[model samples]
Target: MASATVGVGWGWWGGAMRIPPFRTSLVVSGVLVAGLLLGGCGTGTAASEAGGGGETQGPCAASGGAVGAGAERDGVRVVGVVERAGAKESASPSGRVSERPGVSVTADSLPGVGAAGGPCAVQYDVTNPESEPFTYTITFSLVDEQGRAMSNVEETVASVGAGKTVRRTLEQAGHPAGGTLDAGRVRILDVERVPSDEAPAPAGSCPASGLRLTADQGDAAMGLRVVGLHLENCGDRAYSLEGYPVLQLLDAEHQPVDGIEVLRGTDGIPMAGGDDGPPRPVTLRPGERAVSGLAWRNTTEFGEAVTVPYVRVRAGAGADPVMVAPHLDLGTTGELGVRAWRKDETDPGAGEGGNGRPGAQGPYGGSSTS
Candidate 1:
């Protein structure tokens, strides 16, 4: 496919809990991830970057694509223009048009890949400089020139090794806040890092306990919010569970959220599709999935409003604690309600309708691409 890409080094700030105080529209020239190589294109590297501040390579002599990329900050690089994805372009006189490479770009819209595309996405390089492995829960968003958030995507990068870096492509969910934003608006909203041992096991990975854990993006209506917590026996052994999962609300910095009480079940907060049924002894065989839920109200009545971005969960006593990001916008309610665990009976392959994520195995078991 034809391409239009550039490599440049730009830096930005990181924040906690919610969106950061400021945002950066970075143009990175680097890739640390290993993936399918383009059939006719050379692999990209920061060391091969061109443009200002370094030795440059003009657009690939034959194709206009920016052949290389550059530096990273806070262990991340937002490789400028990736897989242009065949979007029609009206070159802004300064765009590095893959179909006509050699042009330099300070800013331009990526028709189907950026704000022009219904789904906003970004490529991120996350590195763990610490000696031990760590997992990161990174929040990415699209914002307007006003700096107001248009849409947000939360993702988990599991087990980044000490001094090693990995890359991921994250996309926003639903129609999003602004529906669609303009170009150069992708920003890093927040980053929370935790020791791998303390982080939740990803859905496909089997931890020592032989189970995997994950939480949904959640839904809210009329100030009420509900998020599903999923657990599966990814290993060969059967796992047994009874009662509600233990919960801990955490701030962006990973500290316990104060003042919010953890209610035992959803009775305190009512909502549709909520399971108020009794907890039953459920044993999940290999490939079996169980689900629990969380409920809360974001009604602001007084004092200070609360927004928790993390939750530490354990299936039961003696089980490992898994960190889930249900992004509790608890308002000033000071309470979070939990639901008992029950075996999931939904067909694994069912789209679950609504805004489905691209491809199968997409996060949240989404059946379709959003």
Candidate 2:
């Protein structure tokens, strides 16, 4: 008997409240709302500090720490070391439902077809470190292997900024796919916040690669340093940078010096989806922006002590090709009197005409490689 049914809500405290994740093939149910202050009137303590109606104490019992209803009676707990969110954690994306305090969940990962696995991603950090301004709500859950029920995720606005420590992402979206669920059996990750007016939205980018590398360029030579990629199209439709980028040259011991003529193409045209050339298209109009740069040259030769030469980029489309390894002091870029010969021993246009000499075009008859 396996099952699935989940629904939990809290929109700034006003409406939407339906909680149920307590199944029974083995017993699994979850609920930890923090603002109604036990109002249906059960566990005592002036009905949870007048939250039952004498009013004025519900800020989780006026923040004075353990203010009633047994502090949490012993079951729900997953805040883990958030003493101020300042120690290491970063990764963000997927948005459109926010209210910062931090934490949201609706997880799932189970026997997942034989080896055991499912559920993960339980991170949180909001930061009102303690100057005042604070709001919260964080919920996350998952259950399988006889417990019957599987998920009950929840995220309802969060705001904590007096000292600043924002870092939060919760999307384990019903986990339970197989192959041992990829071996990480996440039981039930967590986070919750409450104090509302809903305000915490900013997470979603790569909007067509609008320049974001943050600093990591290292690979040198008189040329082979293409660290300039900036494009933004936000998406409503319109994008085509064509494609023909595969520049490689790594010698000075980094190896691979065989033949040297790696320019790809520029004036002789030929530069779109190459390997055979024929489908070159470039059009962008929907908030428009595009810029490109990549050039290489280091045939290797002249003193030959170059040491770890670099520059590797391969573009076939969109984005995902980066390898810049800079580190050369070769008499400061003259390639240090280079001399490592190959490609049949130079002179194909020595000063401009020698290799295939016929008015010079000696990088091997370029017309998309005739």
Candidate 3:
């Protein structure tokens, strides 16, 4: 079998829905500042005893009860958690936590500083216990080596139906200052339940012509590369998209790459940014934009080179197909991965900080590949 990896790119057109990667780095940065204030002093250790007869407790000692590896609360259980280094491409499974009856949650090791020092990524597995669908938010707090919380917190929304399990990964840059994060100290700050049917109905299918696409190269490590896809609604009315886009690989001549496998986010592709919940209705008004994540690996243990020059994408079922030349070079793997569309606040379409309204350029200007 051929070794495979994934890649992503971004593009935009007139009156069309262009999907772009979400700007979670800014949120992480802001949260980091807030966390610093809430944490007061930085990680500090108390002085040792003069005679060394007894050890003095440090202020940075773990306070809150550790919640992982079989910890349960309010009908929810924490299976296990792991910490990953570098980009997710090189991430391997560790710290296995067994599943039990009732609702359970497990966190994959969150990414540390990438090779380029960008934000770390996180993936979570959430299982719903009830027969009905359940929507809730999960938050991650950075902890120091001393087992004290740091100045950074990241949260994502997740929805799982009864007896079903859903996995979600954080896309976007994360900057958790103060060295490596303590995987054991990382605990769930809150998990609020929300309405399962919160998503609004779509006005109609988004016309391909009304959407614009822009592609940009993103972070890479361990032979894995990321392409940021930005989709904007140039049409006059609102439009919505749920689920992953249909991606077909293309050769240098823009022809389909034969035997290339396209993997959906649910297929175990580690994604950054966006929520893990059921496709929420991201109703974009005229000029609003959304984002999607794409990843691919190019390294091969042993095989011929797999060259992918272009990619053709369909926003959703029945939407017109748009061809984008990401210029990705996935050598000999013949595999590409794509994530579902999520709202992006970094573009001009959605006003600076306001939701879905026209705003100023966010921390990330027009587009960012990292």
TM-scores for all candidates?
Answer: 0.58, 0.21, 0.38
Q: What is candidate 1's lDDT per residue for 1-370, written digit by digit as tens?
A: 0011111111011101233222222222212011111121112222322221332222111122322232244555554323322322322223343543665434443223233232222345677888888887665565654866755555667788888767554333222233232224556656667778877654334687788776655555577777667777878888898988998888876789888888777777755233446677888888877777678888898788999988999998878898776789988888888877777655543432221211123212221111
The models' CA-based lDDT, in order, is: 0.54, 0.29, 0.45
lDDT of 2 by residue, 40-65 (tens): 11111222111232323211122212
Q: Candidate 2 regions off by >4 Å?
A: 1-121, 125-164, 167-274, 278-281, 285-370
Q: For all candidates, what are the clash counts?
A: 9, 39, 57
lDDT (tens digit, per residue) of candidate 3 on 266-324: 34444333336555666677877777757777666677787775677777887666555
| Lowest summed lDDT window (length 10), candidate 1 | 6-15
Off by over 4 Å in 1: 1-131, 137-156, 162-185, 189-192, 200-203, 272-277, 352-370
User: After TM-score superposition, what is the CA distance of residue 124 in candidate 2 from its true location, in Å?
Assistant: 3.5
> Using lDDT as the measure, what is the rank order of every candidate, best first?
1, 3, 2
Model 2 gets an lDDT of 0.29
lDDT for model 3, on a 0 to 1 scale?
Answer: 0.45
Return the TM-score for candidate 1, rounded to 2 decimals.
Answer: 0.58
The window of 10 residues in a row where model 2 has the poorest summed lDDT is: 81-90
Full candidate order by TM-score, most accurate first: 1, 3, 2
